[model samples]
Target: MILAAGQPDAPLLELFLAATAGNVLGAVVNFVLGRFLLRFEHNRWFPVSPANRQRAEALFNRYGRLVLLFSWLPVIGDPLTLAAGLLRTPLPVFLLYVTIGKAARYAVLLWAYTTLAG
Candidate 1:
């Protein structure tokens, strides 16, 4: 969408803000779902894999809440946020780190789009 907008005219700031806001909102929703699903952590049908869950937990334990900065990662990202909720990572900290990661990602994409389009 940002690239599409740039095909004609780029509102880079708007695109960045909108993308970052959406990413933050989506992660928060994931966090809420993770919090709500805490009861099912031990269930056999739990969506998250035991191995991956353990890995995310270990990373969180080692790095503390700041690990949320990597929540933009593809394979491990969602699990990281889920683990954050499961482990009771503070909302403010989660939002801060996640926003930074997501915004940085979008900023890079937007920059690349503009550079290529130009």
Candidate 2:
């Protein structure tokens, strides 16, 4: 989706907005899941183990919500948003940081594509 946005005839601003909106929405979903799923941690069906949960919480606490700036990252991004939910981060704070990170990522990618390909 992002790469497609960089096509020569693509509507850059529209694509950027669409991609950012969709990506941020996804992060919101992860955050919501994490916020609610922690309640079921004791269930055998829970995906995350207690030890892992503690470790994730520890990392999140140590780094704080500022880490949300990297929420645009691939492997760790989704989990980071989830951690925010688990830690009960404020929704506004989560949205602000996550949006900034995701939007910046797409902006950089678009700029690079234009610069290199133009």
Q: Where does candidate 1 clash, by residue pair?
A: none
Error of 2 at 37 (Å): 0.5
Give the residue spans of candidate 2 off by over 4 A.
1-7, 49-51
Give lDDT: candidate 1, residue 55. 78
Cα misplacement distance, residue 113 of candidate 1 (Å):
1.5
lDDT of 1 by residue, 1-48 (tens): 435564556677887898899888888988998888878878999877
lDDT of each: 0.83, 0.91
- RMSD per prediction, one decimal? 3.3, 2.8
lDDT of 2 by residue, 11-95 (tens): 8888889989999999999999988997998999999898988888898889889999999998999989989998789999999
Q: Give the TM-score of candidate 1.
A: 0.78
